[model samples]
Target: MTTSTQPQAQAKRDEHTQPQAQLAVFDMAGTTIDERDEVYRVLRESAEREGARFSDEEFQKWMGTEKHWAIRNLLTIGGVEATDELVDKAFAWFRDELARTYTANPPSPMPRIEESFAALRAAGIRVGLTTGFSRDIADLILESMGWTVGGGEECTIDVSVCGDEIPSGRPAPDMINKVMEITGVDDPAAVISVGDTEVDVESAQAAGAFSVGVLTGHLTKEAFAAKNADAVLELAADVVNLPQVAAQ
Candidate 1:
């Protein structure tokens, strides 16, 4: 079953606070925040239109991949012989559907996400967004929520690493490192990486940062643990309730 909301118990994430805590790096799509599975949903439709079919498993694997990589890799793994033209076609379809989905049924923050973000800010922690979303989509999500970059009246994050901005995607520390550079948080120990995949965990570990695995995206607990994450939980919102995350 698709996990829809985070539990209240998981909301008590104020427990693990150190005076020197510097940054909280959040993954978009299914970690710290998300409205719906728009990308996956749209991709499935596009695949069908392209005379290809996607299984549930296949879709899950594609959930948070960078757009270019997701399209290219999906075509490759599916033996579809992807070309730039074909990938562009697929992307065009996805973009069209994305607008429709959001316009009709806009997505909002994942459970406790806003709360946790607020809590982190209140506690003086710098917040950053690292996502596999295309820049256009990422901008939409932030704009829809009326958030700005850098905490002000808006839900400003200190840094945002969009899929289009990075040369390497998840399972690599490039995105996280970008965030650290933006936040000026040199010590990995003072940073916490929250995401929903093995790639996210591996990336955090590669960056020497603590990792929190949230089961809101496409991965399972076992899958997350296999990568050696520091903690496993339900959602980013749940982190707000966790003493381990919220306490400072």
Candidate 2:
């Protein structure tokens, strides 16, 4: 064998010895969990409080953007003066509405989410979450779903990187990078980031991580295709049984 072939063979051997430390990052609301339209739904309901009305088209366009960006755009397009307090108040209303909705209709684990996690764990791979939802909200969702990080009778997620945890949010690579920092994983090629939006794909691509897109969320499969998504599939429910995921 040639000198160059040795490293490739060794790498393959190493992969079999270890679970490959394949870190997987998931987006919360809409991606791995329910609560689709939660943002816009809350925005529309909070219109009266903001003294404005949000256009459905415009709101849909801002799907993957952070809450602040969406709120800023809503105010700007509505010709309303932007103030720190006003922005804060608007988001507060959205959160309040979200909390109410969640209390009444808490999100259940996405189809196959538990199965996918179990498979990854069984394989010794680590799983983490990256979501636009605030850490506070993330905590609530996890608690409701009974997710534990280490291991248990149920499931354990390795880590979570939330929007508020870092200065920059999705469409930025910071969240994924933070997951890397927390997990101590260095190679992006070894990591697979999954989500249901362009922002998630962009973040993964920016971080040089393999990206998986899903049609389970707000964005269509074609939308993910347009972003040059690495792999497109059904919801997390389908993740566990896939040959690709199974091989991973």
Q: Say which candidate scores most in lDDT.
A: 1
* Colliding residue pairs in candidate 2: 111-237, 112-237, 148-156
Q: At residue 42, give the lDDT of candidate 1.
A: 77
Writing each residue's lDDT as its tens digit, candidate 2 over 1-248 gives 00110101101112223233467788877778877666557765554466665666665655665776567667767667768888888888787778788878888877778877877867766788887777777788888888876534355688887777776776778888888888878887777778887777777777766677888776777777777777777875554544444675
Listed in order, each prediction's TM-score against the native is 0.83, 0.83
Worst 10 residues of 2 by lDDT: 1-10
Off by over 4 Å in 2: 1-21, 47-49, 52-55, 151-155, 240-244
Displacement of residue 126 (Cα, Å) in model 2 is 0.8
Clashes of each: 19, 3
Model 1: what TM-score?
Answer: 0.83
Q: Could you tell me how far off, in angstroms, the CA of residue 10 lies in candidate 1 after the best superposition?
A: 25
Candidate 1 — worst ten consecutive residues by lDDT sum?
1-10
Q: How would you encode candidate 1's per-residue C-alpha lDDT over 1-248 as one tens digit per residue? A: 01111111112123255335578898887676666667677766776667665567776666666766777767766668788899888888787778777777777778767767777777777888888777887888787876678746355566688877876776667788888887777887787888886667767777767778998877788887666677788877665544545556
